[model samples]
Target: MFIRGGNMRILFVFIASILMALGGLPQQTESAKILATLSMPGRSQYIFVENYLKALAARGHQVTVINPFKNNKATPNMRFIEATKVQEYAQEMLTEMDGSNMWQEFNGYTRLMEKINSCTLDDEAVQQLLKSGETFDVVLAEMIEAPPLYGLAQHFNATLVGFSSYGTDFRIDRIMGNISPVSYNPMIIAPRTDRMSFSERLTNHYEYLLEQVHRELVHLPAMERQYKKYFPRAQKTMDEVLDSFALVLLGQHFSVSYPRPYMPNMIEVGGLHIAHKPQPLPEDIKEFIEGAQHGVIYFSMGSNVKSKDLPQETRDTLLRTFGKLKQRVLWKFEDDQLPGKPANVLIKKWYPQPDILAHSNVKIFITHGGLLSTIESLYFGKPVLGLPVLYDQHNVERARRIGFGLGLDLHQLKQEELEAAIHKLLSEPSYAKASSQISERYRDQPQPSLERAIWWTEYIIRHQGAPHLRAASRDLNYIQLHSLDTLFVLVGVPLLIVGLLLKLSCRLLRGSKPKSCPFADKQKKQ
Candidate 1:
């Protein structure tokens, strides 16, 4: 009886193995073609692009990436396409102009548009892409501003997917819909009372108008001229063509952002940065983190800002503040030397930010409030002390006010204030609690962000550009797109029509009763 039972178990194992083999458990085909463009190199943007491409290749797809790097450096299973030489004219124009504040942003935009307009459609990058031996099923463009690649995607008649490095701001949606490309950060969670504030509303209104003017008066004309020059054979207007078929994959998670209405194609795919397995910290950094006694505070201004650019007085104030703090400080300063070294402070040009945040000894992150930094702190369940410098940093820091984090203006930094903010964060535990709650929400998402991005990219290819997801802006006219004017016209028109009719009716009644028509007089006599 025991032998018979053993024989039955063996049979069950054999059958299960056979079933697994027959099911074709790989679950994906090996030869599907995908083309991805990474317009920037050696930046966080490239990192996100590389990961997504790797994910696709792992899923049995043939992936080719177009990287702008000229040094022939790239990962396995990826190809690099050298971008065209930037025009000297554009460069000189940008240099001669003083770009300060919002005007600087516009100057950058103009230069970019000029470059796009000047680029030849048959440039080496575009030719190599078209002539590449493999037939691509789909093309994904990294940013809204990558004109040559966006043009190439059109030329190849492949499905176009837009990957935004920022969150799903309404302005990006407008660009995809051919409405207007305004700048906004959807990651900021504005409180109801704050949104209603007169100052806030006024700022919003001014931004909206400024965006519209920039798009209609400044950007669109240049885009149209470029479209005509590069894609003359194309039938549709630049506006219509851009809006025809596209999807926006934002690098943000819904959990951390404010609740707002989003279209189906505008997907939230944050935490793609954290999707990969964490790398082990180097021995020196590991030892420093392990040896901390009163906990550690991580400070970084992110990649774009140079710590050396900070004024000497500001740097001295920061160093002094760190000296007073009981916690050990890790400052990501580019320079090795400080005027006075704090006993507990360690200065490194760069730090393995994620690994350090994961450490138990780390207590708070002092940041420039860049979106990625803020999100990373939230991902690791650590609170932030934001020092906003430029661009959307203001929006990011303000948004964090919804939670337990604190924001400090970079322009208002004083030794006492910095010390006070740092001390408060160390003593209070609620900030960490709030951050962890957000982290839990992020973890509870249905699937990892990279997986969602890959699935959507492939799904669009499978369904022939996913036309069903495209938004229809044809129903929207000039007045409708700008609706405040439409409301005034709708109300004003009815009142005018009623007044005109009343006057006409009164004139007819008076004419019939007394003087004007002979027929009216004859009828009255009868």
Candidate 2:
């Protein structure tokens, strides 16, 4: 109780050291639980889920992937939640519609939308998974279609992160108050000078409005009624849940996308699924690439398009053009045989695209202009000869106009024109230079896209939800966001006054003022 001054100071120093040590101790890393939902079993989806889960798991986190697939043989660290059969949906729809033109395509899409809209999160299998008592910090749902995933997020009181596989327009519109549902076809959605006219724009808007009305009034209400029939206790409406949710993680790059205003939470994490390490090329493919004296031309129609589906006329034209090119060609075709032998062209069913693009000998890429392919071409600093088949290809081409002048439409494609474009891309240095400039911009990203995505996801979890990142667009009316109301107030009000004064002057002598009341005279005297 009775201590000397020197001893008291020493005791204080000892206490302070202990407190400092305690304060500087490393914070305990919490085990984060995430539920990742991929609607279908596809290479792209698989890669994205796998990489994201791996990244999370590597950082001492737990990931559970829920998909239509039952095969859980891939990664050991993560858990899998198998849903009831849904692959049959796609198979049946594809069979029913077949590959048809735009009108038929719309009909097919409508049918599929109806089918997906029927699914509920409270199904027996879904409930069984929930019974395990596993709680998640966040629900990462793929933007396949509007589903009960948002409801699940609400039920768990967890953050909802939308993993968008498409471009910004439709998804951005969905996040905002715009209820118009536009069909996403790169070929059509991507604005083209030759294809999209003023009338077409009006038609697109009308179509979107009709689709939204159908979904909200007819489709979603019916689904909710059906879900209530299955689960009597489910109280939330699908529309309320979807509209209330914020944060859209888009799988798109600004370099490949057209200029548009976006919400703060609308992040462009394009190429997140791209493999970091290059896969080895087969011996024959290696030899073929090596054999080219000038350079190699790589041609692929992306993941969806099968080369066998190409029309005979188109195939023949492509082959003939390849025959004339001085550089060797690598064609990714499913078929083994060709009509005529082109000495320089090598045909293969598959090619390691990223690896080939990274190759020094690869001078040009002839692509169908899928977003991923276009971005990769830009990432590798190579000029693209786009033969856009469908979906956002037109948009990609339009965006590319600012930099590389290498995009060509499939409709305008001919042997002569194809040859001319290819020759120009190869011979002209500007295309390559422009492409490289884009690649530099892409390479100079603040961080790797996947890391940025992971950081944001974790940050959301830590903060209970990063509401600050959500864009003001969600709360703003169209007029307010675009300043249309302000413009009208400033310009229209002045113009209206001038017009009224002119009309009044016309009715009286030119220099005469309009009759004033006693109130005006009183105010002037005051």
Candidate 3:
């Protein structure tokens, strides 16, 4: 009672420390052993998971990643199991995937996923890792096309954490027991804004149904084959693996993407792949960008889509259009030579995309509408003119909906149209204003996406899978999830009661009346 103020403060600190150590207060979990796999094809997909795993490793976790895309640079606390064979199959299948044809694209991806899984299991490095008798705290895997990788979690008796490079779709929504209303939540295959017209909602609902049928009839069967082939002795079945995800981190945000519902276990960590600040550009590129008398226009088709693959006519149109522009153009062309390259244009095999977008001289981005590219453009506050091809529709549609960009049909593109679109983006102040507003909202988070992703990941490990965050709806069947059975009772019971009342009234009338009506009987007697 007579202790000095300093002594009392020390005593309070001592008590708090004891409480924390004794588990009365929260404390950091010990380092974890993480087994992660990324079987998705694109470099963009790999970037999201790679950055996340790096963060986990930096936080004292030991990570082993099995991916086709290998980081040559060696780093401590992380090991790479390069499954290079996955790439061969992925590329071949990607070429066959026609984004315009729904069934064709679905079948193509289904076959591709099967081959990718088989190749992953067949890889010597992966085989050795699996047989190494290694145990892990968690297995982080891409949720989209790599369900077979879930077996690794079962093998190691670890929780499975799903990592998606895009927002949740119908398949993911169903698995996670999240509500994705068709009226507003657009299907991945059918792109639309949240505010849809009547026709758009109808189409969205139809597409959603078709997606569900495809998942059951086509996608699930393909996944089941891969699961059984690799993990025949797995403790849980394929259905169980689909349902047991501890949590999923989605690289989507409402700032650019449409607002949608998510479960407690579904975390939005959009833009985690984007650097907090752009990295330095190479000397040549920096000079080209800075030396632009007018602002520079940056064009890229992302990693999977090569600019060199464009038809000769389209290429000519682009060159001819760029030739007329006052601005300098920087294009990410895969080929070494551009036959008709414009004097105002610079072609490189690759450019540091985010760094290029970050430059003050950059005016607008002409992109293929890949999710990562869309996010990067918004992050840098640059208006876009998107030439969405294949799976690029959704991202481009979002850009158009947000008023920061415009989309052109790649198939129907003409020189006049291309020039007009580019000029519109540059001349319209509203486009730049919208881009800046969205960029501010996108960056206005309490913490960075990378940090949020890492903390949630660690939280799962600390809380032993965090089962409490999981939705109860995961246990419900389709009929139950939608309350269809409840609806049947609600409607059928009222109808049944009315039918019974009608029957009773008929019976009462029949019993109270004579064989003939009273008046008719009287008339007959008279």
lDDT of each: 0.68, 0.68, 0.86
List of clashing residue pairs for candidate 1: 252-270
lDDT digits (tens) for residues 26-76 of candidate 2: 454477877777654234555554666788878888887776666647665
Off by over 4 Å in 2: 1-29, 40-42, 45-50, 68-73, 81-107, 116-133, 155-157, 170-188, 192-232, 244-246, 275-283, 335-348, 403-413, 468-526
Question: TM-score of predicted model 1?
Answer: 0.79
The best candidate by TM-score is 3
- As a whole number from 0 to 100, the lDDT of residue 310 in candidate 2 is 80
- Model 1, range 61-154, lDDT digits (tens) per residue? 7777665445455455555555544433433433433466444566566665565435434457656655664467777777655454466566
Query: What tens digits encode model 3's per-residue C-alpha lDDT throughout 340-451?
Result: 7989999999888888999999999999898888899999999999998777897788788879999998878899999899999999999999999999999999999998
Which pairs clash (backbone N, Cα, C closer than 3 Å) in model 2? 185-391, 186-391, 186-392, 187-391, 190-395
lDDT of 1 at 386: 84
**Worst ten in a row by lDDT for model 2:** 179-188
Q: Using Cα atoms with residue i matched to residue i, what is each candidate's TM-score against the true structure?
A: 0.79, 0.73, 0.92
Choose the strongest candidate by lDDT: 3
Q: Candidate 1, which segments miss by more than 4 Å at Cα?
A: 1-30, 40-42, 68-74, 82-104, 112-135, 146-148, 176-196, 227-237, 335-343, 474-526
